[model samples]
Target: MTTAVDVLVVGAGPTGLTLALQAHDHGARVRIVERRPEAFRPSRALIMHPRTLEVLRPLGVTDALLEQADTAPKATLHLGSRAVEASLADLALPDTAFPHLSLVRQTDVERVLAQALADRGVAVERGTELVAVRDDGYGARAVLRTPKGPEVIRCLFVGGCDGPASTTRACAGIGWHGRPYTEEVVLADLDLSGTPGGSGAQLFAGRRGLLFLFPLGEQATWRLLATRASHGGPGPDFGQPGPPVPRSELQHLLGDAGLDARIERLAWSARVPLQFRLARRFRRGRLFLAGDAAHNYSPATGQGMNAGVQDAVNLGWKLGFAASRPHDSTGGRDAEVLLDSYDGERRPAACRRLFLTHTAFWAEASTGPTPSWLRAAAAARAAPLVPVILQRRRLVAEGVRVISQLRVNYRRSPLSVEETPHLHGAPRPGDRLPDATVGVGGPPQRLHALLARPGVHLLLQRDAAPPPHEVLGPHVTALRVANSPGRGLVAVRPDGHVGFRCGKVDAAGLSGWLSLICATGQPPGRPRPPDDAG
Candidate 1:
């Protein structure tokens, strides 16, 4: 049978599910297919970075996810067996309401987002696979294999959220470009009985290799990851429950530092390489690649899953915008320029993440025979520099503040004026405002909420003319403020940001700003589902 939708998403994981939900909300018909018959029960990627939390707040899912899981706001580093804890609270992130990172399982987060979508009446198709994809200018066509039968689906666009060996990516003919890491690491989930030297995510390094313990839940369950032997037996497959590690191996791994813990449940295990790579191109005609399909990074910092989530957010609105306009003023359904921005912006950003993450892991786990005395001495000398390096590492390495979707600026966009004061300095139309307790509210509402109603927020100075305020109607808001530097008519995008800002609120500037965004603005990509009329 042949089916049709605005978007065909091939993967029911976090990235694919999110894209489908947002597209459906944007009034674009979407279908998601996953090879797995059901959602995984065990947790994966337990750390929910602050930035991902901030992105979910607007979607109305952050609170629910937090309720299901707990936060590990602090992570400790053990240098030469001595622990030095660093509170994520110390780091500064002006963009996000969630200034600190949270430790929540991937399964829990997926459940929350999935339930959110189901509540809105969208469901993902499981035990299905995207067998073939062919793009022919007007749209892309996909063939999916479901238990019932073979089905053909055609859409204006397709987003591949499938994992590294994505069939959709191959169908689109996108090529990967990077080398795999030499060392392989094994990760296993365990119900830990022994006490670790530190709480939160703990890092233990020695000549044997590096041991990383990530807190899962209740402080009893945790994840243990370490370098696997080059010539040892094959590592356990992640698809099945893993074999327990011998107490002797655990003793040898921990050495004199102390950690003879009994493990209860072995959820999953896998031999992972520290690999970094990106797809040559994100978009091929009407099809787009996102998450792991577009780029792959080391799991050392737990950024792989987070980066994929951001991809869906960035592309969702653009696809929604193009698909929403039944026909542009140009009498076409597609906006090539608008669609082009997805790859232009995201590719560079993803590449930077891959490079930084690789650098961090290499430094953290570099293996060579060094004397015990030398290692202890090095740790003492490196204490001061650790905090500074960690802070910058957390920020840029993780792209925590900006890439998390807090302070993204389209100021350099071809659709935007290449000139504006925000372009030259701090606090631009795109940069997220520092969390401030404005008025009676504590921590106040985000700057985004003020411009949430719709259209441009023309912050006119007290004496300036309001411009043709009527032309913007309910879509635009002209706020007259007193003594605010952020004043002056600022055109805000539908997604909530100052699209254009003028020194003074003038009719000409307002008109120009409105024209540019209207011609380019995209609505938030979330749909009310088919039966959401109630």
Candidate 2:
């Protein structure tokens, strides 16, 4: 069998599903193909940061997802013997109504996304693996292995969210660059009681290794992660099982450090390596990669999933915008440029995460046996700066009321322009819009509510009126504000970030800027303006 689609997504994980769902909502015919015969076993990624909640709310499922989660307002970080916590009670979450982390399993998230896609009339094919992928000038050709038989799929664009061993990436001949940790990590989901929330995170620093216990769902389950002994040089293959580590071992290792708890080992224990790798390229022709396919990092920061989801969110709109455009207007290059930017922007961010994770691993007490003297030294060293580091990490992790997602700035793109400061003006491409609750006044009943609707948003400052707002697809909204210094006519991307801004609320300037960055310099029906107009 053979099929044609506007976009063919090559993974069924959170990232791919997000892309699929968003593209479908934006009016594109899309299909998702996953190698696994079923929803992949839900393994990690339980923390849904505040920024994600903002994105999910716009999709109309934030409440439903929160129903399945335990909302925690703080994340604690333990440095040796001292534990300091960052409370979400005080974060400036941008563009979100709910600013907190939801502890929902990755499986639950995938299930939610899959259902959303289904409700929107998009189907995901399970057990359909892409064996070969080739891209020519016209489109992408993928040889797929379906349950019934072999098939070929032709798509205007392909998104690879296929995990670390991504065949799609390898087929594209992209090299993954990074280093792997010599230590192995043991992950266990165990039943627990009385773990404190907002008590922050617990870090055990011992000579043998480091053990961490994170609050999972009202203390019923705690995520226990530990680093393997480096001196032992990789213990018996993690595949084999051994008696639960003696309570004395836990005490000797981390128990004495601070955590007063017992391990009730359950039915599951698996060892995974701490490795960091990123694809040398984010895209190859019509084929593009996101999530673990594009990058992989240690679970230290719990960013693997969040980063992947962001990748999906970033690429989804671009693909949707490009795919839905008329061919005559795009000249066929629109899709390529929009798709190529996904890798260009996301790859560097992933690399930074990899480096940060490594730094965290090196700081672990498990790097070697904790000597009594070393523990004292660690506690002493942590007394000063550990608290600061812990706060930043916790804030980043929980992201409740924080700008984790919207904090990303894309101003460095070749598409951006430099602007000067003005009294009442538009925001620049990379600036984050301050949070404001606009009451029902303009066309839309509410302010952020207007964002829930489709199209780019241009918020103008007081005393500035945008030139007769032109209609372009579901694109561009112009609004006026009372006091927006250097933030007039702030153009926000569909995913909700300031994409283009003007100094004087110049309609032609705003339009020209939007045309350059948002639409790749082409306004649907408008003629190109003179160079100085910008």
Candidate 3:
């Protein structure tokens, strides 16, 4: 039988699952499909950065993740003969609840999101493969290979969350635009003994490149990620893993980096080809590229998964809000603007992330003579001063924040609108709404907690009234805070970024931003399920 959905998500990985959850949470009738029957892929990413945790907060799955995730793991940097204990846990980032990175496998993240979607009655169609997707004027028609037979699905949008070799991207006529790194990351989840530090993480830096050991606490106790040292060789094949990273090779690499720990028993191992690639375009027609399909980063700083999740969140809500609006309501202009902003906002993020991962990869793993000398110099110099550098609170906090992607903002986005006078260092429109204590007549409550209630929130300060429904339109909730440090009207978007801000409530400005994102005139409280398109 043919099916109809608002968003037809291809690839049921972390990005696709999260995208499905957010779209369903914000209103779209989402159907996520995975080409693979089961999630047998390797969990290459283990650390969930603070910004990613915060972004997943509103999806109602962050708490579950936090319960299972390790947020307080100590880190030790292996600098030749000396080991410097680095603490990202003590960062002075008070604005966010997740100041430190959380140690959890990418598989767990997918499981959590999949369960959340199932709870909302949206089960992933496993073993479902996308055959073709062609635009059909008002929406798109996708052909899928289901167990029963060839099934057709009519969806307002198609989300391509598959990996670098994305079928959806190909179907959209988009090609990968970035290059692959020579070095490949070897992943092994095993138990270790004779380790020098607590059950946390260890980073080894030297001419050979960076090696990471983390207490995964899932599938295995320790997760080791080391970049293979090769002399300007051809990149490993993408998609499927190459071979099992042997135990003896791991031991040799371990001893070379100054770790005395021995692998007790190898639980799982896979070689991930490191690639730095981005899509030619994030969107084409009614299709949108997300996750690894949109951008693939070398396993330099664990950006591929995090960036993909952020991309999903950025595009999901826009899809939900836009799909909720009838095509004739605003002549599809409203939906177009919201959909357009997905590329405008997320494509740049991918570009910036590509630069960051590329730079890190080049310095750490590049095999040229000059690059090797530079690496040796950095490794030799870094070991001595690493201890002293970790002592600086400001520098450490900034570094952590930057790597955590907490400071990522969309100030230049078309959806971002600011009318308030510039208060130096104060929060502005397009910033992720910083968390603060909000008095609700009792002790206190978190601003993020209240904003998590759902929809675009109009937060009023000190008993200020919210704009009427006629002005701001549907799917907007307004709440007055009892005690707020800053007095102004802040419109927090569904994805938790400040969409509109003003010293006072400017109803017109708020409405414009809402309309721009197609947040205005949605189907009342809950977005009505889209009519069957088949």
Which model scores highest in TM-score?
3
lDDT of 1 by residue, 1-534 (tens): 476778888887778877776666545677778888989655557676776665455566778887865553667777764678766653465544566667777887788888878887778778998889999877887888889988887788999998777787898888988876655565666666566766677766554456777776423467777754433455433222244555455545556333546565555554454456799999988889999889887666677778888788667756765675546454252367667767886787787778777776565454544533334456656776776777575554345564454545556664454233232322465543344323212333445444333233454443445565334533345554343334345454444444565555555555554544333223333221111001
Worst 10 residues of 2 by lDDT: 525-534
Error in Å for residue 244 of model 3: 2.1
Clashing pairs in 3: none
lDDT per residue as tens, model 3, 32-115: 898789984567677788888888888889998988777776788766556677666747788887878777878878888888
lDDT (Cα) of model 2:
0.63
**Ten contiguous residues with the weakest lDDT in model 1:** 525-534
Output the lDDT of residue 158, model 2: 86
Please list the residue runs of candidate 2 whose C-alpha ends up more than 4 Å from where it truly belongs after superposition: 74-88, 92-99, 192-203, 215-220, 230-262, 328-330, 333-335, 365-376, 380-406, 418-426, 439-449, 469-471, 482-488, 505-507, 513-534
- lDDT string for model 2 (1-534, tens) is 376887889899888888787667655679899988887542567677666665554566667787777675455655554556556443444445554556677888888888888888887899999898888767888899999889987888888888887888988888988766666666555654456334644556555456776655222366666776533345442222223444444434445555655555443444555557788888888788888888876665567777788788778777777776556654355455556667767776676767766666666633544443454466556666755654574454443322245556667754344444433333466554445665334332335655665456656555455444352224555555543433344667766656655566565665555554346324354532211110
Task: Supply the global lDDT for candidate 3.
Answer: 0.77
What TM-score would each prediction reach against the true structure? Answer: 0.81, 0.81, 0.92
